[model samples]
Target: MYIEYIAMELPRKLIGSLSQFWKINVLDIKQLYDSVEKLVFVSISLEKRKTDVVRSRYNSTMRVPKALNPRLQKQLLLRFGVYETVYPVETTPSRTVPDHIEKPEYVLQKQPTVLPDKAEVKDVNQLRGMRRSCKLAANILAHVQKNIYPGITTDDIDGMVHKLTVEAGAYPSPLHYKGFPKSVCTSVNNVAVHGIPDLRPLRDGDIINVDITVSLITVITLCWHQYVNSLQNNAIKTCGPEVPFSEIGASIFRHSKRNGLTVLPAFIGHGIGRYFHGPPDIYHTLNRYRGRMRPGMTFTIEPVLSHGSKHTLILPDGWTVVTEDGARSAQAEHTVLVTEDGAEILTK
Candidate 1:
């Protein structure tokens, strides 16, 4: 006998592909040997829900593939079920995550926000505290950018930032937060943000952007955004002059100038508070964010300008964001507290 199992919970996309593959390859196995006792086909139905969890069920039916063994089929079905249960629902594209493939479940699931929070600071004193956080972030990036080069591993950058932040009696915000595995984001070349520090050495002609944030007074402030824009613009204006930062920074800045592209004001700074990213997303271009800048308001200014397109890629680690076209990207960032006259760079 042969059994046919219905797979009701499978996504239509995968179901379609599997059905086609089965018909073309498995359908030709028409009969079992005289010793063949029974056959079963298990169909698993997958339903995608809002929470990134899938509800799946197994259907058993008589079939050639199923006839191999009941226990084997059961094991296969169980294994697939378990995989669907724990795998992430969203993933980076193949071109982006070439080293490690993301699970299909995560690729299909709902995504969390790119920026985490909308924390606010309403008082001037509170703003000062926020600036302190920004300064820590700024100082950390300043050191990393100055030292990044061909012989330096990304992990070195992470270690340096981690040690510096902790030495200052401050917490490196990204460590163990939301599963980010690094103290700082050192996105080199194509990697954009959240690049895990590895043994990968910075190349002579390569570019990298380091993102840092610190926590102070229960507030999370971002400091890399504005610094990126300022540095990139400055690099372009200076050409081959001494950048004080890494050569990559100068290359990105100088390349941007050659493109004759105006840094879009619409893509500049951002506010931070309870939430990691808040309103009044500042841009380098000349547009106003209705999100008012008030005292005690802390934000990040990391402007990313590309030699070609700003399109990006996510690394296998899930946090690194890189340029898609393999073009160079330059960024400097600073977390700051909004003030009456201007702003205080906390991480500086």
Candidate 2:
């Protein structure tokens, strides 16, 4: 277990580079009320070029970046591992933005993808099996939530969760999905959703949520894009696209993006079965996700609820997401099996 724990910390080393080159500051622009665009890289992938073997190795005396939030910065230091580490690069006027991203088209958008229809389930027996898997996964998450407290880094929580999942013969589903570097979702205040787990620790007033999904290669991509378009349609109705950009727009757009980053807060959760992303898409905000809950269908119901406005900050890493307002956030998830009568929380 100790050796395995060491292996998981390897990825943070790459993410840690961001803080090394930049100093974080709140500066104002001469003309506008807002300041110059704050650039911070929140993601780094050694597997970008090579996926098979763990490529980069750092020495023992490595330094982690100071998170904008102080408690989180300390937590990251304790969570460094063989796979990753959290590097903070504070940016100042003296620093230079990387020229490698030369094109305007290189922008990254926050969006969620639409999942294909879930496969048909034959009967209750199959649903029961799926329920068991989800239940087990949920229990693991519960363990994670209980263990993760103020002063614990996100990476520490990830390490603990990864160990527990492997011990139960399950894999951390988020570890390598399209090269996502972590095992779990760690959304702090303002991070609407899809916040990568890091060395950052929970704070006294922080409300964080960790969405738990199973590790299934056979399962379709859990985050479906349809959810985003539906929400965007809702946004347009509530306020026309011509509406001025405010902090509120930030929150709305984060959830409305077609990518999987912003998950529905209210209508989150689903049934898991042979199809990991089954019918009856859990609407985050009373919206329609289409499909029905059938017996033998299993899915996750992990919603990323936030505080106040929905605007979010995308770490330069492009994956570690945070809320723009810095308000606290919280989430709870469980896989369920559609039974003859109702639903069963599998990850309890």
Candidate 3:
């Protein structure tokens, strides 16, 4: 499988142009972000202009376009053999923290969207904060994990997390950030992430990830927002919005093309500190994301793999992500603390 156990490096080609993508006819800018403003693009469709095959999917309002985060390089893809969509975008107002607490050194006048170096090691203070935050997050996950039996609704799990987070004197990190309503992310089998906790009950063997991130606050805010951490093993479960374009997106695409499996290319694990999602984005698929793991740095490296075709669609909620072709998926994750010699799974 995938040339695995084959001791070798092989040649590869990466597409450098958005224009060369097939079926793309028009990609225009409805607006641009000023230097003071982060670039937010109003997404538009090029489908119908290329073929009437695309003319039928619009409400006209659909063409009005929506803003997208600047990190996304390109996303227009062939869809349903007919329909198409440009993913939605969002921006957050600066978060405020107490003046007495010490903040991470990275908070800039302008929120830095760039990621830090890989496997970053944490200083004594940052490590302490991260360790405590991760433990809290893990505790929350463990508290919620007991709810995964058949029939307990996903919303129930979320409610438990929110209540516990508040009681513990921390904020539910995801609530109201980027319009996400749920505090914890409960991604059931087949739904990679951003599965808004709803009334849907769990069934037997339905593996789920109860991702908890608490804004550990008493004195300071890292990056001006709540400093958060995660739980789970050392694999690829993730909190959505934290990861934008996955580095693994490329390899998944190639491997899927070779093996006839489906690959979802939309997300990846990222560095989380003062600002919810920053750089040093961890990629699960193979690509040239240069971030490395070192002591003092923290990030998430979740990669969602599918058993079917990798196509996906944004939900009507404008946030939840799901497979378009009905493929069952699985993911695992952790907030990693790079140590002097190796990596430490804080969630453990």
Candidate 4:
């Protein structure tokens, strides 16, 4: 009756603060709803297998807010059947990265090898390089974001990013990082992070995260003037040096009582320079242990916020991560330099 469906699915930590505004129901991923309902899709939680409170493993859950009309609820129950405590599961498919492009450390290694470096500040030259690479990443995302209207496939986004990154003489940072298959990360609604861009098409009212990580060690010095100058000017003007691609989802749901954007604060925005991902792991949300930003520092401030529960599930592929509740999510990231007074957005 009230705006009970407003908040996007968030983690338990934020539920206390947000629960006062909305009520929640946990549904499975296979339980499709009318895509017509704007904010009806999201990932949440529940006790699966009859009181066995299992978090996502094979079957994923999505947070469906109670604020939706009775018609929606009836449709969900009908398709999904009794909110089955014993959830029927399905196998998640996987993909591959092309051999022509360069890959990061994680692809060969069984696990992610990038770590945060503890150094407080970077040198002047280091800042310049970081700025250039971040600019490339921002530009790639900007181009991908433009093509993100309904009817476009997430895979199409990947193709565009790959072409742009290669044409710029830079590498798509995420392509083979930890065996991730795509050039850019395209997280459609209900997915948290690492949503592999595939055949899924974008829909109106749906949200997505197009995360572009670029390795510009070569590209920056070669001819950044061509790629960086054109898009760089526009990105700063529109997003104000903020990562616009990442902000789309959060902006869509920010003030909605029925749908909120829940970003992942646990994932650290690492220092990006010579190495694609390294130390000084920055916790995007609130944290007491991390150090303060200092001059010459270079790192990312990318937050992957979802439209549903903050809880997440890793797909069978091991590289792709999705919101456990099966909701829409987006990530906005920027490589920032700590200047004398404040910070500069390298990805601006």
Candidate 5:
């Protein structure tokens, strides 16, 4: 299994006087992961008024100190080459979907409002629609995977996703949803999530997550990340009936910790069906969100795991989110339905 890493740097203005100190903090993380032979992913952000100190939203156990023993800086530098930062490039206008394709409400609204607090329980017909949408989403993702390699730009991938979903007589859900410009979310290397596809071409050794969503009568979303020219490990797990929703995150957290990785807690899974997103906010980190899986309820579980710090920052685009430390990160997702006996991976 290839563990993902993401790194980010503070804005240039914040690093002015404290440049050396910030570099040391970043190096400390590099050294911490180098000992385990794992790539590290981290995000650092400071309050505008308190630019001298970085703060993390993760619990005490997961927070990385602002400073660490700087003795291993040289060793880390020698082992890991200079970190390359990925930035947004010029993107073409959003593609058009045929009039026959049904669009989600957000397409007309220009923004998806905050979802209702209660999760929707799908009826029999809704479940069938969900299954069909998810199957198509999975197939499209697989089709896109075959075309991935060096020299293919992420915007190219978005075009492919848009064409496939439209050809299947379904709408590309991400289009116009909250003003996202692309048909799919293509998160390269250090971009944790909601990455807007751009003109940047895929390079060897880069990790890219292609998140696709389709809207038929019902809606379904799934994400698949590929490690270019490298083998991938299937690290996703499924849960059975009687499992509390909260425990799902706790278990994932424990497993990631044991494997020398950290979970980016800022993003969580959610209920899906007829809408792009909804209730039962599934926190992938340890949390007290209350609820339990029940038959006929469909949702997504997409936890982003990193090799370094867990903090992240949103770019000015108002959509893309990148790690603060410029480290790499990877993500995978599946839409699932609760069954009487267990859970079924609808996107599998």
Candidate 6:
């Protein structure tokens, strides 16, 4: 069962881009805030389970016992060439943002936390700031895409993100926020959301999601998933003002089910703006969260779709979330603004 949180107000807008190697598919609703907009590309191909005997990684031929527990079955599957499992490696110290760049309020706090209790209505000036930051975040993601290839560690991507963000006179929002030690999040294959960057080199045929957030006068966040040698699809849709927030998740759930996928309900999109996380608590599954979109409000709608069971677990590092059944997951996100006539994609 999902524990519902008190609904709060927030801003909304949408941002998107299409690449030659990607297919964009719009699913449903949810809202989150940030200057950055995210697009997730998920490519899933389900195959029949194999019962044939196979060679283990140790070069010995063996057959996985059908009576083994699910966890052991997953391990044997990995060993028998179902898919490669991702693991964390030594990560370097957190990269630094320039002292001259503006920082978020949470960075100055002893506990470094910001709890947004209400949705914020953006004024003209605030909206301008959001656009600027969101554009910067999108540009940074485009730049990072050029560097993604086999043998490049996620930590290298983090360094590139940190350098580009600071050089642009903006702060990387993920740095030092709530004690997170990386400037960006890189989740590969079975790893779900909030996968911290480490020394693991990306492999060919690996799929990865790169989540980027930056802070100028306003904070913006965006995420995109790419295949090392393949591609996938993701898209966003906007609604008119006063629409029930719950409808977004319902629509996405329907779309995912129709596509033979499951939505991971544990994580929700959130209200974003000056702060990294805030109200609205955009659920990707059907729920009773109370709220309606209003003009000038901004938020994000990012949903993670799984090719297998939706169950998940957090790593010992307290951040990296992985699929409990070792299934692969994909995610897509965008920050949107509710306008009088309709919603706008700010990060587009």
The whole-model lDDT of each prediction reads: 0.49, 0.44, 0.50, 0.51, 0.70, 0.69
* Residue-by-residue lDDT tens digits, candidate 5, 1-348: 111233233343433443444544232233332433433534343323222222222112212223233554444344333344567789899999888777777776545655657867688888888888888998999899899999999999999999999999998888887688889999876788889998988887677889998888745566554431011112224455556788768877877787656689999988888667788787887899887777777777888876556878777688888776665677878787888887787886
- What alpha-carbon RMSD in Å does predicted model 6 have with respect to the real structure? 16.0
lDDT tens digits by residue: candidate 4, 1-348:
112232343334544554543355535333223442333424344532322322333243343423257896565444333221112223223334446655555555645544444733666676666667666676666666567788887777777877887776667767655566666666555555666777756665555666766766532211111111222232222232223223322332232323333555546566656666566665544444434455665665555554445566555556566655554455555666656555566666
Tens-digit lDDT string for candidate 1 (27-120)? 3332233333332244222332322211121121121123136796565345322111011113222111122322222122446335534435
Best by lDDT: 5
For every candidate in turn, the CA RMSD to the true structure comes to: 18.1, 17.0, 14.0, 11.5, 10.1, 16.0
Clashes of each: 77, 69, 28, 32, 16, 33
Ranked candidates, highest lDDT first: 5, 6, 4, 3, 1, 2
lDDT (Cα, tens digit) per residue for candidate 3, span 1-348 = 000011112112211132243334446543232331433344445433422322222223221112133232122112111122222223223233334433332332345345453433456877687777777777777766655678887777777877786676777666655667776666655456677777766665555655676777421121100111111232323222223334234534454456434435577776765556666676666567653444566776555666544556555566666554444455655666555555566766
Q: What is the TM-score of each candidate against the true structure?
A: 0.53, 0.50, 0.58, 0.60, 0.75, 0.73
lDDT for model 3 comes to 0.50
Q: Whose lDDT is higher: candidate 2's or candidate 5's?
A: 5
Top TM-score: which candidate number?
A: 5
Superior candidate under TM-score, 1 versus 3 = 3
Number of the candidate with higher lDDT, 1 or 2? 1
Model 6 clash count equals: 33
True-structure RMSD for candidate 2: 17.0
lDDT of 3 at 108: 25
